[model samples]
Structures are given as structure tokens and as C-alpha cells.
Target: MAIPPGFLDELRNRVSVSEIVGKRVKLVKKGREHSGLCPFHNE
Candidate 1:
């Protein structure tokens, strides 16, 4: 199967809620995108 542009592009790093919370994020796979927590702040 083929993946979307934005999806593969963003996966290069980590999952960003700011990027997700702003738009429609459809997870093709469940729990795989849990990431290291929200990618908003550096902490």
C-alpha cells in the first residue's frame, strides 16, 4: 500500500499534537503513533 505525503513526512520525527489537534489525523494503525508524548513543548 501507498502512504500519504504528510503522513510519511511527519513520521521522520515524532507525532505532534499541535499538528494533529489542528487537523484531521486518521491513524491507519492503532497505538503505533502514541509517540513519546505530545510533541508541542520541548519540556
Candidate 2:
């Protein structure tokens, strides 16, 4: 099934990226963006 328009936009607005990512990784606010080490890569 196809998703309706504005659904993703509304979801993104409702959810928090930092909040979700912070649960798995430590995030540091760098200006307007959040910085963190990659959990998938061995770098």
C-alpha cells in the first residue's frame, strides 16, 4: 500500500531524531546538527 502525502512530514515533526539516536549512541550537539560515532562501522 502506498503512503499518503504529508504522512512522513508529520511523522518527522512528531518524532525526535536526537532522542531516538541518543538512546543507542551518545550524541553531541554540534551547532544545528548532532555528531556521534558510527555504531555500525568499526571506525
The candidate scoring highest on TM-score is 2
Per-residue lDDT of model 2, residues 1-43, tens digit only: 9999999999899999899999998899999999999999877
Residues 1-43, model 1: lDDT tens digits:
8788788767856876536754643334346553233345654
List where candidate 2 sits over 4 angstroms from the true fold.
none
Cα-based lDDT at residue 20, candidate 1:
70
Q: How does each model score on lDDT? A: 0.54, 0.94
Clashes of each: 0, 0
| TM-score per candidate, chains pooled | 0.26, 0.76
Off by over 4 Å in 1: 15-43
Collision pairs in model 2: none
Q: What's model 1's overall lDDT?
A: 0.54
